[model samples]
Target: MSKLLGLGIAATGLAHFAAPAAFEPVTKLAFADDIRNWTYRNGATELAIGLAIAAAPTRKAGFAGLAVYAAWLGKRVLARR
Candidate 1:
């Protein structure tokens, strides 16, 4: 489960760097016209989180971080709706 979640998050993080435009809509929610920069930042963040989660030594902290991150993102997305 940890591996799966970590891989999923990492994959999306890579996507952010590989195709930042794909995240413009979500990034636009907070960054407005500066979506690209925010996308890269978010990608880096996700990559770190994913790596932490994948590593046995940091799984606990990673899950906690992911919980907070997920809630924050959910709130933002919901607020937009």
Candidate 2:
């Protein structure tokens, strides 16, 4: 009974956390030189992969996704400087 209760709570927590940000609003920025714009192009990809990992059920897949994301971020950071 305790195990089932724990599982239910954990599952509910995960579901709420995994839910899309319902209150956030998207706005268009007009600046062309904004570094965020460039970062968005690069970081968006890694962010997606990280989310994919976070949502993955298996540890191996999640870790693999994290590794890929780290490598990608490292490459970008090194390239900038």
Candidate 3:
């Protein structure tokens, strides 16, 4: 289950890099400039967390990190409305 979740998150991260334009709106929520850099940074963060979650030794910490990240993103999205 952990592996599956990790892979899913990682795939999304990869998608961010593959199609950063699609993520620009979300990036705009936190940044007014250099959106591409922010997008890449976010992608890197997700990639790291996903890799951590996939690794047994770091799975717990990764899940915790993911929870926090998700909550933060949710807040940002809501704040935009």
Best by TM-score: 1
User: Distance (Å) between predicted and true CA of 44, model 1?
Assistant: 0.7
lDDT of 3 at 12: 80
- Cα lDDT tens digits, model 1, 5-69, are 88788888889999998988878885555679889988988988898898889988888888998
All models: lDDT? Answer: 0.84, 0.42, 0.87
Candidate 2: clashing pairs of residues: none
Assess candidate 1 and give its lDDT. Answer: 0.84
Cα displacement (angstroms), candidate 2, residue 23, comes to 19
Ranking by TM-score: 1, 3, 2
TM-score of each: 0.81, 0.36, 0.80
Give the winner by TM-score: 1 or 3.
1
Candidate 3 lDDT by residue in tens digits, 36-81: 9989988988988998898899999999999998888778767766
TM-score of model 3 vs. true structure: 0.80
TM-score of 1: 0.81
Q: Please give the lDDT score at residue 68 for candidate 3.
A: 94
